[model samples]
Each structure stands twice: as C-alpha cells, then as structure tokens.
Target chain A: MKEYQKSKINRIKRGQNRATYDVEKIDAILDAGFIGFVNYIFEGKPISIPMGYGRKGNKIYLHGSQANRMLTSLLKAKEISMTVMHLDGLVLARSGLHHSVNYRSATLFGTLKNLEDDLAKEEGLKCFMDHMMPGRWDGIRSMHQEELDRTLVAEMTIETASAKIRDVGVNDEPEDYNLDVWAGIVPLKQIAEYPVSDDQLKSGIKIPDHVMRYYEEYKY
Target chain B: MKEYQKSKINRIKRGQNRATYDVEKIDAILDAGFIGFVNYIFEGKPISIPMGYGRKGNKIYLHGSQANRMLTSLLKAKEISMTVMHLDGLVLARSGLHHSVNYRSATLFGTLKNLEDDLAKEEGLKCFMDHMMPGRWDGIRSMHQEELDRTLVAEMTIETASAKIRDVGVNDEPEDYNLDVWAGIVPLKQIAEYPVSDDQLKSGIKIPDHVMRYYEEYKY
Candidate 1:
C-alpha cells in the first residue's frame, strides 16, 4: 500500500496540515534515523526508551540483552509503538506564540513478536547494523555463536504509521510582520566529526573504505 | 535530594554502571536538548510523541495548542514520562556484536498539571522559550492575552529520573583486539548553520545579537 489506513489510534489530531499517512513518506522519515523511542507500560505508567532499530519493509527489528527489562515488558504487551524524529531547524518568529521548530517525525504502531530462530535473528541483526551504517555488517567480523545466543531479537510488523513534517520559514501573524523583529530559521543538523582510532588497534590496520564513506556521507 | 531514590519503575537494569540518578546530572542532560519523547496510551497501545520542553529546578514545562491530543491524554493519566537523548558517537567495534553508540539519555517520571492562571502559564511559556534559546524570550514580541488563552501549558514536577551516559571508546573482546580490524568512534554532534531571514521581514532589521550568539555557540 501507498498509504496507511487512518484509524483512531494512528491519526494525527492537531496540526493536521503537517500530518501525512503516506507509507513512502513515513518510511523516508524512518530511514533517516536509527534511534527511536519505544514506549512500554511499566507498573501502569507509560515510559519511553531509546533503542536502535532496523527497518525492512514494514518490519522494524530491535535487539537487546536477553534479560532486558524494556524488551521483556514490551513482549508481554503483544503490541508496540516507536517514534523517530529529526530536528531540522528552529523557526524563530516575531512573537513568542509563533515560535516553532522545523522537524520530520514518524510514529509506527505494530504487532510484536520474538524472532527466536537463529536465521531470523541473524537477518534482523544484519538489518539493524546496516540501517545504522550501510556496508558495516560485511566489513565487521561476524557475530560469534555465544553472542547471537544471548541476544533477544524481536520484530514489529507495522500495522499503521504516520509522519509529520514542518519545513517552512517563519510563520508570523500578518500584523506582526510590520514589527521590527528579526525572524528567521537557524538550521540544525546532526553531523559526524573525524573518527578516532581505538587505543589498542592493530598497527597495520587502516580505516576501511566503507567506514570512510559512511563518515563522508554524514560529515558537514 | 541530590539523587533520585532508586525504585523498580526508575531503575536501570541492564547498564547499571552507566546509569546515574543524580538530580544535577539528569538536569544537565535535559537542558542539552529541547526535544523529548513523551509517552501516552492511545487505544490501550502505549505510544510516544516528540515535544519541545523546558526544564526548571525539578519541573518540566510543555506547551501546545489547547486541543493537543497528547497533552490532554497525559493530563488525564495524571502522570507522564519523557525521554531526551543526544547521540554522541557511533562506536565501531572489531566484531558486530560489540558495536554500540555513545549517548547521553535521560528518562523522567513525573506528575502533570495544567497551568490555568495567566501568570503560571506565562512562566511556563517563558521557561519553554528560554530553554530553546537562552535570551530570545525577552527579545521577542510579548504574548497577547488571546494568544495565551489559546495555548495550553502544563508543568510536570519530576518525581523520579535516571540517566545513562556512554562516552568511552570501543570495548571489544580481549582476543578480538589482536585481529587486524579498525575499531574506533565516529563522533556525532548537532550543529547550527547560518540563519535564513524570513521572506516578509521589515527592511532595516538586522539579525539580532541573541540569534547570532546562539548560532555561534552551536556552530561547528
């Protein structure tokens, strides 16, 4: 599908102009970020935990230690929601009431299930790593058996999702435009700095092309 | 109290060594970023929404349109949780299993209440704006009564919180250090670009000092 079916749970209420249910737009927002905040109810209180996720089609893969509290609680709930956001710029308006930020945010709702089989878990891990940094999985050494055994991998088959984007300049009141106020946007972006070598690296090992390429793509 | 009391709801189970319950440290983490993921329950499914917030002593302030769905739901629940995270770096390890990210993340649990009185609401709005840009609140045009009436301001008095910080280099297995692999950290940072003026601004208005100061402080 081209768009997610709007339901009571997945609809964006306020700022309807900024909302979109298109699957591709939502996927684009999701693909731009690796860390997402996953919500879980703990002792009747809803809490959010930031987790690294890999998206494949409508499926999001998350992995953690076998004994992770957040993961286990979410599994018991049978369903989950995750939100990823990228803050693009600060929209400074003439008046305090009009101040806003330009951002792209996507929230996903899905049914959750554990990927217990070894092959499924491996694929999930690959997706997770590749999502964070492309070409990373093959460049790094493969996971050891014990490492895979202790990790708890879970999949969320996205049932519905929505994305909201606000990318314009200052939106002030017509009357406020006459005032002598400095209003504009200060663009903000997450950038990568130079990589630092580990303290105990082997002497002859050079920074791989894949690593340099990833840095260049993210660098300012 | 200097540190939040440890309890089942606020404790960090997996990475206890990296967790801090200190009030000062947690506040520092919160002050670094204005955006937070606030959790709420929709159709019995816990979901998170990203919102801009302002933090004072032990209180977090959030404001939105009077009809905001997430804010209303949070007020109805009478409790709330928010998470703010800053991704510091990507830790590229020798093995895929050891790969991780360097971050400073804080999760807050609190009681929520509406700021009904104009003074209280104004204070909340000030906190919110000042948190975004230190000196922009006083510089901007003051809020009119109608604008304040249309806005809903809420304050959350933090009851408990936890912060986890991971800033070290790659932590690979002892034996994997002998392998000819490039392991290190690629530092990540959120930066500010030059301000883009609004299209409909008054002719003689120059970029204000406050905006330039903010850009300079955050610029690369």
Candidate 2:
C-alpha cells in the first residue's frame, strides 16, 4: 500500500499539518533509527521502554533475554506500539508559542508473534544486529546454541503507521517576526567518534571493514 | 529521599545490575534530554508519543495546545509514565549475543495535574522552554494572554522512577576474548551545528548571547 489506511488507532490528531501516512515516508523514518520506544500496559498503566529493533518489509524484529518483562508482556497482549523519533534541530522562534524542534517521528501499531523456530530465530537475531550497524552480524562470532536458546525473538507485523516530520526553520507570529529578537535553527546531529579497540582483542586482529564503514558514514 | 522507593511497578527485572533508583542519577538522566517518550492508553492499547518536557525537583512539566489529544488524555487518566533515554555509544562485542548499546534511560511514574492558574501555567511553559535551551525563555518574546489561554500545561509529580545506565566498554565472554575478532565501543554524541539565522529576522539583530552560548557548548 502506498499509504497506511488511517484508522483511529494510528491517526495523528495533533499537529496534523506535520502528519503523514505514506508507507515509504514512514518506512524511511523507521529505517533511520534502530532504537524505538515500545509501550505496553503494566499494572494498568502504560510504560515505554527503549529497545533496539530491526525492520524487514512490514515486520519488525525485537529480541531480549527470555525473561524480559516488557517483551513477555507485549507477547501476552499480542499487540505492540513502537515510536521512533530523531531530533533534527532546535527551532528558535521569535515568540515562546512558536518555538519548536525539527524532528522526524513515526509510530507503528502492530500485532506480534514469537519466532519459535530455530532458523527463524537466527534470522531475527541477525536482522537485529545488522540493523544497528550494517554487516556487523557477519563480522561478529556466531551466537552459540545455548545463547540462541535463551533469547526470545518477537516479530511485529506492522498493521498501521504514521509519521510526523518538522524540517522547517523558525516559525513565528508574522507580527513578532518584526520584533528585535534573533531567531534561527541550531541543527542537531548524532555522530560517531573514533572507535576504541577492545583491550583484550586478539593480537593482529584489525577493526573490521564493516565497523570502519559505519564509523565513516556517521563520523563528524 | 535520595532514592525512589522501588516497588514491583518500578523494579528492574532484566538488567538488575545496571538499574538505579537513586533520585539524583535519574534526575541527571532526565535533565540531559528535553524530549521524552510518554505513554498513554488509547482504545485499550498502549501508545507512546515523543514530547518535550522540563523537570523541576520531582515535578515534570509538559505543554501543548489545548486540543492536544495526548495531553488531554493524560490529564483524564490522572497518571502518566514517561521515559527519557540518551544513547551514549555502540558496544560492539565479539559475539552477537553480547552486542549492546551504552545508554542512560529513566522511566517515571507520576500523577498529573493541570496548571489552571495563569502564573503556574507561565511557570510551566518557562520551564519547558528553558529545558530546551537555558535562558531561551527570556530570549523569546513573551507569550500573549491569548496564546497562554490556548495552551494546556500539565505538571507531573513523580512518585517513583528508575534508571538504567550502561557506560562501560565491551564485555565479551572470557573465551571469546581470544577469538580473532575485534570488539570495542564507538562513541556516539549528539551535537549542534552553527546556528542559521531565520530569513525573516529583524535587521541588525545579531544572534543572542544565550543562543551563541548553547551552540558553543554543543558544537563539534
């Protein structure tokens, strides 16, 4: 589908001007970040926890220890909601009411299922690792069978999603724009610095190409 | 109290070794970021929305338009849960099972109250703005009465909270340390670029000291 069918569940009500349901746009926002805030009901109250995720087509993969409270709770509920946001810049407006941040955020609503099959579990784990840093999965040692058995992998089939993007500069009251106040945007970015090699690395083992590639792509 | 009293509600189950209920540590995590992922129940499902917030003592302030659905719903629920997380670095391990990210995250559970008084509302708004950038509230034009009237401010008195911090280097299995794989951390940072003046700024108005100071503090 080109756009998610907007139901009451996934629709964006506030700041509708910044909302979008385009499938590609929402996917772009999701692909831009690996960590998402996943929410589940706990003790009759909703709580969000940051978790790493991987997306393949409409399915998002999440894995944790078998006893992970949040993941197990989400599984029991059989549904999930995840939000990923990237703060791009701070919009310094001429007026207090107009001050805002430039950001791209997407919220996903989906149903979840467990990846119980061993091969499927491996694939899910690989996707999760690669999503954090592409090709890092191949560079790392394969997970031992015991480690895989202790992990719980959940797959979320995204049913609906919406994104809100605010990329513009200062937005102020037209009259206030003429005031003697300075206004602008302070662009923000998440960057990577040089990698620190592990102290116990095997002798003569250089940093892998995949790790260097990730650093090159994100380094300032 | 120096620490939040932990109950089943705020207890850390999975990563107990990394969890903290110390009030000061949690406050530091909250102060380091202006945006929080706030969760609320809608249609029996939990959904998280990213919102800007300010912290004062044990109180957190959130503001949005009067018609903001999330704020209105949070007010009606009379309780709230918000999570703030700052990603510190990528921990690349020699094994996929050991891969993790260094981060500091706090989750707060609180009761919400609307700031009905004009002065309280103004204070809440000021806290929100200053949290984004220190002294930003004074740098901008004051809010008009009409603007204030259209805003909804909610104060959350935090009753309990928990934080998890992971700032250490890669931890690989003892046996894996001898493997021919490189493992380490890639430091990550969110930085500010030089400010760009708004196109419609009033003539001869230079960038304010507060704004320049923020840029200087966060710039690469």
Best by lDDT: 1
How do the residues A1-220 of candidate 1 rate in per-residue lDDT, one tens digit apiece?
Answer: 5999999888888888999999999999999989999988888778888999999999999999999888887888788889999999999999998899999999888999999999999999999999999988988888889999999999999999898999998988989999988999999999999889998999988888878998899999
Interface RMSD of each: 0.8, 0.8
Q: What fraction of the correct interface contacts does each predicted structure contain?
A: 0.91, 0.94
Question: Would you estimate the TM-scores of all the predictions?
Answer: 0.98, 0.98
Candidate 2 Cα deviation (angstroms), residue A143: 1.6
Off by over 4 Å in 2: none
- For B1-220, candidate 2 gives per-residue lDDT tens digits of 5999989999998778999999999999999989999998889888888999999999999998888888998899898989999999999999988889999999999999999999999999998888889998988778899999999999999999999999998888888888888899999999999999998877899999999999999998
What is the per-residue lDDT of model 1 for residues B77-160, given as tens digits with 9 covering 90 to 100? Answer: 788999999999999999988899999999999899999999999999999999999989988899999999999999999999
CAPRI classification of candidate 2: high
Instruction: Compute DockQ for each candidate against the true complex.
Output: 0.88, 0.89
Displacement of residue B82 (Cα, Å) in model 1 is 0.9
State the displacement of the C-alpha of residue A160, model 1, in Å, after optimal TM-score superposition: 0.8
